[model samples]
Target: MTLPIEPTAAQQAAARVRDAVHSATVGLIEREQLAELIVLAAVAQEHLLILGPPGTAKSAVVRRVASALGGRYFEYLLGRFTEPSELFGPVDLRRLREGVVETDVSGMLPEAEVAFLDEVFLGSTAILNTLLGVLNERRFRRGHTQIECPLRVCVGAANALPDDESLAAFADRFLLHLFVEPVPDHQLEALLEGGWQSERAPLAHRTELSDIDELSRRVPLVDLTHARGLLADAIRKLRGAGLSLSDRRIVKVQRLIAAATVLAGRDTATDADLWPLFYVMPTREAQASAQDVLRDSMSAAANPTLRAAVEHAVLQPVSRAARLVEAARSCLQAGADAPGTATIAEALLREIDANFDAKSLPPELAAERARLIERVATPT
Candidate 1:
């Protein structure tokens, strides 16, 4: 567990996360947001809850991340009848014979570095109560079966959030919530292509578990003196707009902000890193409304490793502009004469113009706009 020097550690950790996420997303079309957040949660030592329908590839995304990052992966589909032992493992008969109870955690959720639990809310009360300790304290405690869990991130996926009031506390333990939907019709052709590629190709990179551990250790040491005021102001605006913010969430969100800074290759967090505060809200509806409320404080929010995540969090011109520039650049680089290049460049130009005012466009965005315009006007 040798930690690198200050800024160098940030740079190395950022590169590791970026490469792993990039590899995980290679054949998965439009799922980069999920991949990026998976790495973020691992680095921050928190949990993620994904709200998407049955066929949305939630488990696939988590599995890809685990594969690219080279860790032990465990996945299960939970049901009302799923026994605690089904996930935790069976009790040791030898220990039971001695009038002691303990779980044999070999190849179980407690031993997994990365895990996914589908239909998480359907788990019985006994299961959810036990699962909470793993999420909150990173420990497994049941009778005499106490063990430290090495789990980096536990992703819980449900088709929809539960309507039961009693489940709310358990669900809230998953601090970050992401809502996903079926791919829209326009991307169906790309979806077909990506699906075929995914079946044929393996992930492109491998990262060590120590990379994640080093980043987690760095999260607490990140300089937040300047970013704190920005975050506080954003919270005030969200509250004024009628979004509830519990004191616990307000305190814990600092970890997410610091993790973002480290993953963005910076030692000190700035106003740009405050965008993760949007995720502290407990529900999808609250998150959607938060985008508009916190727009001013987050105009500078951008992350090269997490561009897709930034797009999902903030839909402002600057954020939208980043994605447009990436699209335009990719189209330009694939030989401006490549098939469908003009069509892609045309779409990017139109999107750029629609999202940004030419008279007041940010300089970097304005340059990308010019590049797109030139590519559209002349095919080669």
Candidate 2:
């Protein structure tokens, strides 16, 4: 009998970090995507931006993830009138007496290893300008003094994307732009039933700062050559689809892909590693287009079985429509003049048409969507 092989130290460490992040995210409804991206962003040592409406649990998710990592956490809510001192700490009185302009930089964002800033787009020019260095270079500079920041990752939450051109550069600082939406109707019951139990429970598994540092060190060692050609093709497709990626973002995103590969216990990046690119688009429309481009590219690169699986998943929305169509047919047969029957059928048809427009569905699925819409609209 062959002896069982034990996981290497790196694998064990990565597993521990993954488990800790996962544990923190437990009991969150419709937040798996955001939680996963948060963990990956931390592993990449990059910043993230969460875009969604109020009460979407954006702040809660960031807090739990930061807590799981066992780091000094700082959180702030920014408004249009927010001042730099509010987030970076006030200036020292001793320095003021000497006529030196320097922030205290104690127990503030600059000193924290993990930070969450809500309504991040509302920051004024002064506040945002001061933050650029800390977010990008992990260095805080005030006056003539510059201090290294211990920030591992900074997560920003906003209800909407910045409309001002001035905030564009600041927005681009966050590599991952994840959208958080309310839980689906099916999950609402579970969400209400669970209430605050999940939020109040203490995290059982914890990842120290050292574990993350080790993972960051390992990311660069992962071979990116395997995915380089695929990445290049996908980038070209994205640009052709009218979503331009800056040179700076292009270079930085490579590190994130490699980080994901390392976390998965692989030495080489794969097509699935490009999953994060789906969220990197600047706008919601561009994000949808990028998803189509990525899905097609990943499907082409995958083996026959994997391609079939991807195709199946991509067609799931249409499948749900088909089920709806069947249900409508039954309702019509059972009660031709039933109240709300026609209304429900029309609603389903509209949803099917909307799905077809939103996604780059395959030819077969597109044809099916059209047929379903026609059938639902026509009597009998």
Candidate 3:
């Protein structure tokens, strides 16, 4: 049987790409949220730093992401002794025979479309130092020549934070940092008994690299007025929790806004799309810091849930009338005659009056209901 194709937003190319990624993978904990963040980072063409203890399936997820896109895969386990040669291709002895300064063979760093650096912070000063150039500049200098890489995204897993001062630069290069801890005690027994291990899966559908590039170009155009206020609240909460806000990271946070915008396929980003920024922050302190922010933004007072009676009897008609007017305008755009302006305006006003009358209740009850409706209508 053929799988049904899902309806997608007009500009959200990443949504389709994400579906392809979803079809190829299995066994990611909280797969829905993970998939969304993965697609957002891919859409933004930015790297992520996966922080977890061993066996958290970080590498497996990376493999799945690459499989979905049919990109070149390069994996490395960095250690204290790992040299720059392990990443950049070795010098060609044959090139020396011709007195050539550069070797034509490409290194893993240069040729990789998607790279997974496991135990990333374990590398020597040279390797960690070199990654700074590769990630930020997208180039690796070999002798007198520089090689440009066609890197789509890089996913690096860290067992623990590194102590080396130079490695800090490499750590900062990843725009998104997601920490994956083991499941809670309630889920641990099931996970162990479930016989899950990271394994390769054949691709079910593949995404074109061009689709990813197109998503990057389109994501920035999404507007985010409502989301910006909530995001500002969230960031304020983080600051209140005593997390240091770096000036450089403020710019990075804005970049993820573009990612959120593209994911929703809107010309403007909304509160619904800003949900993932809660997960993309760089530090553990920042992640722990957003709890108050979420509590305040998503609370009953801020975003109350409306009663079914009110929603159906009052809100529905008003919403329907607004949509009907929009549809009439769209019909006019299509060169089809619909209702006249005066008629449509009167119908809308009538609907509004009916809605307000139906929705009216005791003053206190009405206030509570409005609060509840506000919570439900507030974006994610």
Candidate 4:
């Protein structure tokens, strides 16, 4: 038998990112997509905008992911009356005394490597205008205060997409748009149980900003030769379905594809990385349509690190099996050794049976199903 090969540094780093992602997601319910998206956008060096009603765990997920990565994080809620000073910083009165104007950006959005802004569309024109510079060029400029922003990824959240035509251009700057709904009826029991428990602790994993930078640096080095043709075909299919992306978006999707390659610990990209293109669809309706339109093209899509994302994007059985395996493991470990475990275990068993035919279920999920079934049948 051949000896096992050692993992490359890039692959090791990718694994760290994966662990950080799942660690953040451990106790959260139905928010796996957001946790995974945070890493995807961060690795791509792109921004993400999430549309969901309040009481969904959007802020909690972003905060935990940022903490896992160990960086300067800034979070703010923007409103019509919100001032640029609130996010950027107050101007320097000391500089004004010397007949100069500048903003003290210490501990503000510009210096933050990871940021989350709620109600992002309600910002005043000044805030948006100033923010455009940070998101686009990573540069902040004001009267006399100008510095390069260290932002790796920024997430914006709102109850819904903006209806104002004028705000559309600003919104379009964000490359990834995800619309999230509250936990489903079946998962409500788990959601309630998770929230009611006290003494929740944050993830202990330590992933530095440098690891993220390394992954992003690899994006430019990834060979996209084999994947380009399939990506082109996917674009054509999206247009054929009457769901269109801007020429700019068409070009920048390469960043996401390349980033996915880096996250997958590969130096070359392929059809397996193409699932990212689906998340770029501007609207939920367009995304639903393109899911069918580009299904055949991206049937090979898979990512070990982002199993939940791949499953959510492509809806493939293989990815679904991987995601379910993860959920099963979490349920077994995080659940208290108290009563009512069998109820939760039974729900998980039903989900596994619903998704896969008994004969076709992958061995990993099959084993998980067995364990869950045992847990359900055993008396507490």
Best by TM-score: 4
**Cα RMSD, each candidate:** 4.4, 10.2, 14.4, 2.0
List, residue by residue over 1-380, the lDDT tens digit for candidate 4.
99999998889989998888877865567788888888999999999999989989899889888988889999999998998999999989998999999999999999999999999999999999999999999999999888999999999999988889878888899999998998877777766665544127557576888889989989999999989988998998888888889999999999999999999989999999999998999888888898899889889998888888888899888888878887788667755474345556766777787778978899999998988887766665
RMSD of model 3, in Å? Answer: 14.4
Range of the 10 consecutive residues with the lowest summed lDDT in candidate 2 = 302-311
Better of 1 and 2 by TM-score: 1
- Across 289-375, the per-residue lDDT of candidate 2 in tens digits comes to 776766666552221101221222233343344433443453344343543344444544554556556455545545544554665
lDDT of 1 by residue, 1-380 (tens): 99766658667767877878877875566788999888889989999999988888888888888888778889999988999999999999999999998898999998989999999999999989888888888899988989999999999999888889978788788878889989765556556666666776776677888898888889989999999998888888988899988898899899999999988888799988998888778888899899888877888898877888888898766676676677667667756765555655665565567667867677887787788778878746
Which of 3 and 4 is the better model by lDDT? Answer: 4
For model 4, where is the 10-residue window of minimal lDDT? 193-202
Best candidate per lDDT, number? 4
Residue runs of model 2 more than 4 Å from their true location after superposition:
300-380
What is the model-wide C-alpha lDDT for candidate 3? 0.58
How well does each candidate superpose onto the true structure, as a TM-score? 0.87, 0.78, 0.69, 0.95
True-structure lDDT of candidate 1: 0.83
Error of 1 at 240 (Å): 1.2
lDDT values for all models: 0.83, 0.71, 0.58, 0.87
TM-score of 1: 0.87
